[model samples]
Target: MNNVKVNVAQVRYREGESVCFDLVEDFSSFDLGTEILSFQAPVHVQLQVNNTSKVLLVHGKIDTKLNATCGLCLETFVYPLSLSFQDEWIFRAQATDDLLETALILDKDEIEINERIFEQIVLALPMKFICSAECQGLCPTCGANRNLAPCHCGENDIDPRLAALAKWQSKD
Candidate 1:
């Protein structure tokens, strides 16, 4: 879990004035509804917050390590992750349609960015995690990990559900 909140109360409401922050937050794990993510190290973040009097412009970079499971081999591996992000925070009273849809409407000067960071991290991950390009997945018949050793199972063993499809092909 990450609890990262930035306070902009002391920042001057000027165009060129900005506040810089360097933070390291400990993150254990988080549930993404579909999958769970575990962090191998603390999240390092560097942020520059600029107040434009109307909106707060935030630009930052995040770096961290993750313990991820390979989708093909189901083996756990350490994955290094680094990403950069930029966001706009507008006051609820000053929000307008002219601003981009990604702008965050804030009711207070204190902004919590943990959720946004998590969303970014999840979006940056690949659709399927493979340990390596040459990873050999589990054998369907014997349930053996093919990456470790070769399997001697018969290759023509058709699944019971697809037996009809095999017979249909043989008919041709």
Candidate 2:
């Protein structure tokens, strides 16, 4: 019944059986956080499910575009995101006591992967968003974006810790 749920009975549950699925839909259901301005298109997911009798191995990649603000210049730009993940889903009856303590439980007939996919997307986001590697950032004195234009601030603004050394050098 879940959005991303897949019925295990529908797949071939053999030793090495594999199934592939493509998910293309809007991502409005999941909270993408404030850093993401908007989703440009549907999130495209390519997944391969492998059955190992005792467990199901899910491996896939998620692709999407997001509007993000540059941390340095605070400019909004379109950002492309591609994330890959691999995980195991074990049946509750087959899981050992130790695995039951730490592993996720698979339902009797279905496996829900909505939360897992959302979590992976969240983890894949960059800690710092920059429009480009050459971004010059804002000037500290006048709050001017150095990437756009050069500021008129003089270079005489030296660190206070080096002021004594500057005076000594001037005397020489």
lDDT of 1 by residue, 1-172 (tens): 4689887776745666799889889876876665687999998889888887777888989999988888887888888999999988777777888764768777787878787777778888888778888999888888888999989897767788699888889998
Clashes of each: 0, 0
* TM-score, every prediction: 0.76, 0.81
Tens-digit per-residue lDDT, 98-118, candidate 2:
767755578676666777777
Question: What is candidate 2's TM-score against the reference?
Answer: 0.81
lDDT on C-alpha atoms for all candidate structures? 0.82, 0.77
Candidate 2: stretches off by over 4 Å = 29-37, 101-103, 159-163
